[model samples]
Target: MFTGIVEELGSVVAVEDRGLDARVRVRGPLVTSDAHLGDSIAVDGVCLTVAELPGDGTFAADVMPESLRRTALGALRAGVPVNLERALAVGGRYGGHVVQGHVDGVGTILRRTPGERWDEVEIGLPATLARYVAEKGAIAVSGVSLTVTHVSDDAFGVSLIPTTLAHTTLGGLVVGDAVNLEVDVLAKYAERLLGAVAR
Candidate 1:
């Protein structure tokens, strides 16, 4: 599991395809500093296992077909910046909400409104995932945990502070850019239990 707190802004160094599967190598000096094989890392809100530590401040992970189909990681190529976070340790400070790194769906940046202190980004919400989002709720966008500022039937908004703009890849987002979205896991669990009880 992860906390949706981006540890480093890593770049994709290489992507090698092996028929139905592919291997991705990302350069993350901080996250790979003490990394070993088989460790879990969240890459753009997708949990991927570290298949190899290449000993060059980079680690490689194999992306299965399912992960490629579900998240934005499949469209990634060399030089794309991705949010990287190591798996949460037991005693680490939980600054963000619980993040399973399981992306619910992909959303597109519809527009961006710049403010004096922050920016409001509106993302096109997928119909199937709309029920999981709520105003003032937590959502992971490309692995960065953010609070929803507003929600409409087809879209939702998030406010990005100065720190977030400077530190994460979100600042570079443009209109029509695709992003990974992960709704709060707690919300999903609650819905599941409620449905079971109703039945």
Candidate 2:
């Protein structure tokens, strides 16, 4: 489990494709500082296992075909920046909301409204995942946890503060870009329970 707190802004070091599977290498000194092989790391909100530690402040993870088709990680290439977060340690401070690093769906960047110190970004949501999002709810976009400022049937808005703008990959995002979206897990759980009760 992760809290969606970005510990490092790493870059893709390499992407080795093997038919349907991919091996990705990322340079994240902070996240890999105490990481061991098989540890879980959130690479742009995707839960990837640390398959190899090259001892060069970089770690390698294998991405399966399912992951590539479901999330945006398949499009990653060398030099692309990624948000990195190590799995939450026991008794660690919960800085952000619960983030599984499991992308529920991929969303598209629809618009960006720049403010004096912050930018409000609107992201188009998939219809199936829309019901799980709510205004003021926690959502993970590319592994960075953000609060939803506004919501509609097809989209939601989030304000990117100066710190976020300067620290995360979202800062360089443009319209038409794809992002991995994990809506509030609590909402999904509630819906599941409610459905069970109704049945």
Candidate 3:
């Protein structure tokens, strides 16, 4: 589990394809400092196990085809930046929200409206996952926790402050770029319970 708080902005150093699976090497010195083999790391909101931990501030993880097909990680290229976070500890503070590091689906940046002190980024929401999103709710986008500033039937918007824009990979987002999205788990559970009760 994670808190959807980005620890570092990491770069993809290399990607090696191995038939059904691919190995990814990411450079994130802060997250790698205490990382060990088998440790979990959240890469762009997807929980990946550490396959190898090299001391050179880089680690390798294997990505199966299913995860690749579901996430934006498959489109990653060398030098592409990604949000990185270490797994939450047993009693660590929840700086953001409860994040399973599980990507529900991928979304695309539809447009960006710059404000005086912040920017409002509108993203296209997938129809299947749209029901779980609500205005003022929390959503994890590319592993960074952000509040939903507005929501429509097929889209949602979030305001990004200067600090968020400067510290996370979201700062590099361009129109039409794909991003991994994880809706609030509580909302999903509530929907399930209410549906079951109504039946």
Candidate 4:
């Protein structure tokens, strides 16, 4: 599990394809300092296991086809920046909301409205995941947890402070850019429980 707090803005070093699976190497000194084989790292919100500690501030993880199809990682190329987050340690300070590093769906940036103190970004919402998103709710976008400032049937908006804009990759987002979205898991669980009760 993770807290959806991005630790570093890492870049893809290499991508080696192996038919249905691909090996990815990302360079992140902070996340790699204590990383070990089998450790979990959230890359752009997708939880990937560390297959090898390359000892050069980089780690390799094999991305299965299922993961490739479900997230934006598959389309990434060398030099592309990605949000990196280490798995939450036991008793660690919970800075952000609970994040499972599972991408529910991919969304596209529809527009960005600049404000005096912050920026408001509107993102296209997937129909299947739309019902789970609510105004003022927590949502993870590309591994950075943020609050939903506004929500519509077709899209949602998030306000990004200057700190988030400077520290994370979200600062460079533009219209038509794709992002991984993970809605609040608590909402999903509640829906399941209500459905069971109704039945």
User: TM-score for every candidate vs. truth?
Assistant: 0.98, 0.98, 0.97, 0.98
**Candidate 4, 1-199: lDDT as tens digits:** 9998899999999999998889999999999999999999999999999999979999999999988888888888999999999999999989999899989999999999999978999999788898999999999999999999989897999999998999888999999999999999999999999999999
Better of 2 and 3 by TM-score: 2
Say which candidate scores most in lDDT: 2
Question: Residue by residue across 83-157, what tens digits does model 2's lDDT show?
Answer: 999999999999999999889999999999999999999999999998999889999999999999999999999
**How does each model score on lDDT?**
0.93, 0.95, 0.93, 0.94
> lDDT tens string, model 3, 1-199?
8998899999999999888789999999999999899999999999999999879999999999989988998998889999999999898888999899878999999999888978899999899988888889999999999999989989999999998899998888989999999999999899899999999
Best by TM-score: 2
Candidate 1 weakest lDDT stretch, 10 residues? 66-75
RMSD of each: 0.8, 0.7, 1.0, 0.8
The reply for model 2, stretches above 4 Å from the true place, is none
Single out the weakest 10-residue window by summed lDDT for candidate 2: 126-135
Stretch of 10 with least lDDT, candidate 3: 111-120
| Residue 52 lDDT in candidate 1 | 91
- Give the Cα error of residue 119 in candidate 2, in Å: 0.2
Q: Identify the runs in model 4 with alpha carbons over 4 angstroms from their true place.
A: none
